[model samples]
Target: MRSMLKFAFRFIKNDGHRVTAKCKAEGCPWSIHASKGSATQLISIKTMNPTHTCRGAAVSSGPQATGSWAWRGKESAQEHLQGSHKDAYSQLPSLCDRIMETNPGSLATFTTKEDSSFHRLSISFHATLSGFVQGCRPLLFLDSIPLKSKYQGTLLTATAADGDDDRQNGLQEPICEIFKGSYHGYCLRCIAEQLVRDLKGQCSQEVKRIVIEDLHHADFAPNPEDFNASVERIKKN
Candidate 1:
């Protein structure tokens, strides 16, 4: 199953002393059958149709009990496809050290479970921090984009607008602690999209335009008075 998934193939299985499996995708010409001589005997592939339009899998030799061909092939293929998540995580401390060594005056912190599983990580490079402080404005747009991996986590980002539009990961905690006076606000693009949805069916198209325009105006407003005035304009409209 892990090998099939790694190769992006869908499968249906029938499990027993003799087992059969096939790609579940319509018209996918991939199938396999395996049987065991005894409870402790080596499993042997009785038959296999490895030509799959859905995906390509490594074909193993039959009767792999000796780890020569059949069982060895499938086991090694599954293990390789399943990936080295544990091994990669074990090197995280070295990765963190490398990040700091390459970029001095940076922050890199991570938490681990008692058993040494990954908990969370935070990183902010010296260039990123200094650029935000010296060049960018005080408003910070925070967003958590989902990370697609075996161990899923959030790729939190803090973007400074009107700068280079370059972004860095791991700002969920650093923003609160380091950027002491920055406004941790929603991403303007996301807020505007949600605002458009909220305006639907509640107001005319003209009113929606007025509200959205006022939203941008309020966001760019230079003073409290100007911001309030922009908000008040929405009510008047």
Candidate 2:
């Protein structure tokens, strides 16, 4: 997983018992084979030709890794995995700068409280933004997830045209307090979901389905008369 993400190369063969991979170059002669024991699952390197005669290292017209660089990649993975959480927070500015430097047009922002404690951090990669723009989706899904780190925090994420969840259901109380005299509204889908949950243990599936269909039909009615008719069509069952 690390090598694939780091180097952007695909292995030719990899099964439970054996794995074989060659250098990206056609005739680089750099290849490796390893086999796993059936009982113990211990992997053993069977063959390795540790040499690269490739023309040049290339990655999307940028600098690339070759030869002894494998060790460097391993070291990088190790450092990233084992780095201190405190140090990461302390060095966030440098990390954000490096992110923008390496990936132009990326946005990275951080907030600090009055006493200088880290408050929030947000990052959106250039590639991700570009892809979202090209996809031309008009909708966004905003969600807040609680982090399970040593210091608890919320991780808020926004994605283009993602699926729905109970996230909006959490807004009812806050919206009431913030926007006085304004009633909170829910879409037919949310109403149907809440209705289904309320009826799950008590009502039959047919009753639940009929209620949801009536609720949806009420929303789709073209006129007040039709809407009233649809509403009247619904029953307590």
Q: How many pairs collide in each candidate, listed in order? A: 1, 0
Native-to-model Cα distance after best TM-score fit, residue 213 in candidate 2, in Å: 41
User: Which pairs clash (backbone N, Cα, C closer than 3 Å) in model 2?
Assistant: none
Best by TM-score: 1
State the RMSD for candidate 2: 17.5
Candidate 1 displacement at residue 4 in angstroms: 9.3
Residue-level lDDT of model 1, residues 74-188, one tens digit each, is: 5433334343557777777888899999999999887888987799888899988998898787889999989654567889988785443445334556678988988877787
All candidates: TM-score? 0.38, 0.34
For residue 182, what is the lDDT in candidate 2? 87
The lDDT values for all models are: 0.68, 0.67
Tens digits of per-residue lDDT for model 2 on 125-173? 9988886786436677899989754467889998875222336644566
Query: Which candidate has the highest lDDT of all?
Result: 1
